[model samples]
Target: MTMVNLSFVLFLLCGVLINVQIARSDECITGSIRKLYEELNCIPEHDETNGCITSYNCSFTNDQRADKCYYQGREFSDGDRLEHNDFRSKCIPTCSCLVRDGRAEFNCAHYDCAEFFQPPLKKNCMRTYSHDSCCAVGVYCKKENEEETAATCEYGGKVYTEGATFFPNEEPCKKCICKPGFSGSLESPWCEEVFCEIEIHHAESIRDNCAPVYFGDNSCCPINFHCAHASSDETQETEVESTTITQKANDNTPTCKFGNSTVEIGRKVRGPEECTECSCKVPPLIECVVNSECQEGKLKTAN
Candidate 1:
């Protein structure tokens, strides 16, 4: 290849390496400006005094280096309006990603909305709830609209007929009654929680280690029962563990003095008295069993 072509290739390679070295995720506070380099194919803006700082200004394909904003796993430019909600996803709709102090940060407007245990009734106006914003009233009652009251309730994106009782799909356990207001009435749709009463069966509860637990239909609370036994494998494992512990205890057992001799555990000592075989089963206590040792070696031969 020609030396001029080789030099030009080397220069492009050096520029690419310099750009790659500055595509750092840590430059942004929330590590969002890295997407401009990694995903959006952007180059770091290098100044003669400050080198490369891509958190605020990154040159994109648009042929301009502009400040960027990031919010909710997305990148946006300045003056970009962000559509988001609060944690409940039903309130505090005003959220935006904007350049506040030389850096992009998310700015949200938090409102302390009054909460009602039951659905509230708005005066004169036909009330509508919004899942997008916390705005409860969608339409207002004007003086010309004297008889524009709706007899149906609008909730969760669906209009329900008046006096309709239904279970909410989001929460199957809660039952809501839709009582939309007329032109003169003032009641709105409301929901109530149904709790099951528990009854204890004293006689059957203590019958065994395990008892039946029951649950009510479409209810979060169980019918309120207790007790479950270990599985057969679990019981066997517990038994084996107990046996191993017992064996270990016996292996480390102390000795006991039987008359003239200091005997270890499980050692059968023919007692000084007749027909009694005394053995040290536990430390400091010698258990004596009167039995077939009295018949001499006949007991061993029979076994």
Candidate 2:
């Protein structure tokens, strides 16, 4: 062969060998690291000739600088120990990471008596319902009840079990159905709350002042509102009785009179007195309805 041709052939052979080596090197990633990369969506650019990954392209952030894998700006790596920055309770402790069943796992230390009983420097110690020791700064302990007997009525700070029903107060709507327990304990006694139906004699006057008129049965009439006539009333030319009204609160927006307080749209007004809850809603039509805890098992209707 000629010298020029021989040189060209040798050069081609060297290039082919180099490409093969690159391809081999690119496939040399560790199995665990490959899986980690895949999970992070890190597609490494492979060098065909050396078979080595040139770039991981894993998302990195300040917090994950030491991690081999990163995703969504968070860094993670196997066999890492970390502590929760927010929670410092005895039940939760420092955690360690591990690879389990091809997925990342965190093993946290279990709660211990020493940690649970540790006293707070400036807080009182209280026993939890479970009898565990806890700081009492924000804890609400159950009130101690000396009289364990169940009773049908509670009057003058004394419990009585003589009747099947009792009136807790003079309010016509406030009463309790006596349901004596076998153990005769006052814990969660059964009581049926009644909400009386209220009617405003002069609803028009309330509408004139832009004030919501409340009705018993948890409904309220807003100012400047009108109710649609019934199908039967529509066909007749007789006078249509106004069934709806509209009123406004401070903002001139629609308001609902729930019990004694007036509630505006998107605002919460609680009462009749403390035990009741209510809110005013708009959209689909503006209306006020009773949303009280005493409303359970009762028909819910909007006024």
Candidate 3:
């Protein structure tokens, strides 16, 4: 061959080799994994000689495909070995992150000092200690008089000691008690607000201008009506006496108005309007007392 033709052929061969090298390099990039590590800013030094990337600060074992990587920062992946550093021992009892089904789960189970200690081969008691004979490494231990094993209750995102009494911070009227159980279980202790009813009756004479009022527990009766007994003698006189009743404005008690007259709580009013007897009692409740004999007599006379 001519020297010039040979030179051109050699140049074409070199270009083919360069393209092949570029394609091979692209295959090694593993774009998805590289992007993930880049986003986390955790990609480590490349070990070109061994064809591996070393995240020196983290210890991980690669699966067959190296698709999932587990590390000990704030999370773990499935198949991760539970190690001493995975635990947070800064508070009474120790807590650790457990990976299950590719999700991070938390648990608090460490109890004794010995459990916090590493094995002899890996023994390094840098942060492990005993406080009151409890695990005290990398975390605080229960105080001398502290009850470390008490089961706690959680409600509305707040934790409470078992048997604690409190009203929900968001609902002052909802008095609740905490008992040991699952945090969100239906059987968990809860707050209960008790309610009562109030009713007011108006007299026959005032019935046209006045009406009965009803109220629930911790509520105030209407202010318009006075309760008094009618004269039983031949005079048939009606007497009305006014009494002042006041309740806290912030009590959030519900009220109901029946007519023009405001019902007075904890009072009695005679009513010939409907031949009914009524009385207002504590808790702002009102009810009619049935006169069975009178009712029976009326029925008998009618028959």
Candidate 4:
């Protein structure tokens, strides 16, 4: 073969090889690229300027597929649910993960106060004005009633007229009655010592026979109070039970139930009498060391 003819054949071979390479890499590469974007289309097309031809991948990556959400160091996907106490909310307790715009988001439903005021969780139901976002924010049953009046308790976005009662799940250890307020008005729920009694039958006899316990998550009533059986291991079990109760009292939540409400360790509560102050040095135990309460006349004078 002649030298020129061989050179022409070599050039043709080079052109074919170049075309094959271009065809193989015509599509865009994944991850960050430095090519200038012009005709950014999903379909592959040839570009004379730069090889940055294919449209950028507009899909989710492998690590984050199936739509998930991370919140407070927790991962939640579609249909996953969170308890009411799982995360603090000023309104509702339970939160659900829902798909919104193809992403997971936390959604909380409106709580109903009247619905929870049943036999098991609570009885003698009275609406909670504190520690309950549903009652504080929405108030009653989360619906506008045409018959709602000014003398009604707002809860769960609805209205509870006078004499209507609800058992707030936030602080289920308190007892409430559907009766009128202490001063003969519904302005404020009676909030004095022994003001309300949770329907728990924890009498002196029951206390000796069985240990006081809580069955439900926040239910104050314990019909059985059955944490252990009666046997010769009573003393050892009692000591162990006392330790457990002490541990529970110090377990990052409320430890002791007072006349009106529950208190935590190191917390200040009411003292021996009115206008007196005390501290919860131990779980369910109060120590009155600080006595700086001004007399009623002094308070009136200051006012």
Candidate 5:
């Protein structure tokens, strides 16, 4: 080949090699940022913002002189206007990068080491109840950092983005059944609780008519009534007795049967037979009925 041709071919090869190297360098920087965040358990706080590093900011080796080595778009030029002139070299020693006097220092000793790290999503993996992954309400979610964090669940009526703080264990996961007179809506609806209990009130002679009012269990007491001394025949006994009423036309004595013996009710009869013969002994009556006619005067009392 001619010298000129050879030179042109070498130039083309050099261009291709430079492009590949740059690409590799960028990827390395990006990968390092990710690794550093992982080690520190750093989660991104914003949902829309991409991670701290991009391909343009990453590289295979920790170069102290590269402008945009740590963050995408943000570069540490040795002679940038104002501030620390040695911004690039300091970040080399540690992954912990510090900004001082307009200069950035990299220090990996401990960078956001307290954050909760989110595991990468697995291929075709389904999400299950993750009680351990939940955090408290009101968190600045990120992919890996706590303050700058993000989530991968649904919240605030919207689906959470990746790397957000997940409130898997929060009270919102399970809902409490609302008592009566309450309504549930879409944005904020009540959910059924694991176990719910209900209360009932009852008064003597008036059993509680308690039944399940809503999504809970109910109880009844003194609220219920046994058929008044229900007979083997399943009849409720009466509460009143027989009385004697003097008829305007005739003062004939009225009688009632009391335990196989006839006695006079209200007339104060001396003998059971006499009372029964006199039609004064009132018999036990069924409930909801007034047997005061057998008695002298009408006295009202409920069973």
Candidate 6:
């Protein structure tokens, strides 16, 4: 009830009110800065030294382009969106798909070949080496032996080897032919040895019917003549009926069959004249003067 007691109580009350006001002001400033950051896509920087004891904020301006980004009342030095072309865009012909629309734009520091080199949404018209970095065209692989001891011969993996396998099986069936003393050569006709062989069939048929190699990521690979790459994915479709690589011989010689056609291993046949039955004629002598080559021993002795 005394004056001094009342004055003391009043001072304490004033101090408490001031402290409450300062706390409310700090909270309001922090909430406001956070809201601003969200709206402007700016980073928030906390600095309590400059009257910002509770919380602080910062934003990027025209003066600083690369040093800062603001978010949630905090400033970050580095922040970015998804890298553009750095990711390879893989596209397919038969199915509907979704991908980023615009070209992925980014500095080399942020985007590189590993992440964006194989995006699934890139231009499909561009010639691609491989769909998912697996196979290449004209990949020659040597046929595996029956013993399964042979390594797979890849087409362009440093060493080049043409793959061949027998059509029916890995090796020819052994016939029950008993030989006396076995004096003949191991590969002779009487020896009944296993030989690598291939059936004479259309070779040109595959030239046009061969389908493009589909990559694992659903991109079409460029075709190369001898051994083009192919998709091993189960979802991918193959144009031919089980285009399997069977075992066959390595001979390129064309065989003449009694049927309507004859085929050589590598040569292309236009018609029946190239068959075995076709007669080969020796052209007339252009500079021959031998007496025996004439009608008689000495051209009838000059008649």
What TM-score does each of the candidates earn?
0.20, 0.18, 0.19, 0.24, 0.14, 0.13
lDDT of 3 by residue, 149-217 (tens): 545667777876544455554333344555455455432235444111111011121222232332221
Candidate 4 accuracy as lDDT: 0.38
**lDDT minimum window of 10 residues, candidate 2:** 195-204
- Measured by TM-score, the strongest candidate is 4
Q: By TM-score, rank the candidates, best first.
A: 4, 1, 3, 2, 5, 6
Error of 4 at 264 (Å): 20
Q: What are the lDDT figures for the candidates, one per model?
A: 0.39, 0.36, 0.36, 0.38, 0.27, 0.25
The backbone clash count of each candidate, in order, is 0, 23, 12, 16, 69, 37
C-alpha lDDT of residue 57 in model 6: 26
The TM-score, computed over Cα atoms with residue i paired to residue i, of candidate 4 is 0.24
Cα RMSD, each candidate: 30.5, 31.1, 33.6, 29.7, 40.1, 37.5
lDDT of 6 by residue, 163-192 (tens): 221111111222112122323223322223
lDDT of 5 by residue, 1-303 (tens): 999999999999999976766555433331111222222223322111322122121122234332222332344343333222222221122333345565343333322322236564455332332212223222232333335233233444655343222222233224322222223331222332221101101111111111111110111111122222222322211222343222112343333222233333233222111111112212110001112243333233221
Higher-TM-score candidate of 1 and 5: 1
Worst lDDT 10-window in candidate 4: 32-41
Candidate 3 local Cα displacement, residue 116, angstroms: 45
Off by over 4 Å in 5: 31-303
Better TM-score candidate (3, 4): 4
Better-scoring candidate (lDDT), 3 or 4: 4
Output the better candidate (4/6) by TM-score.
4
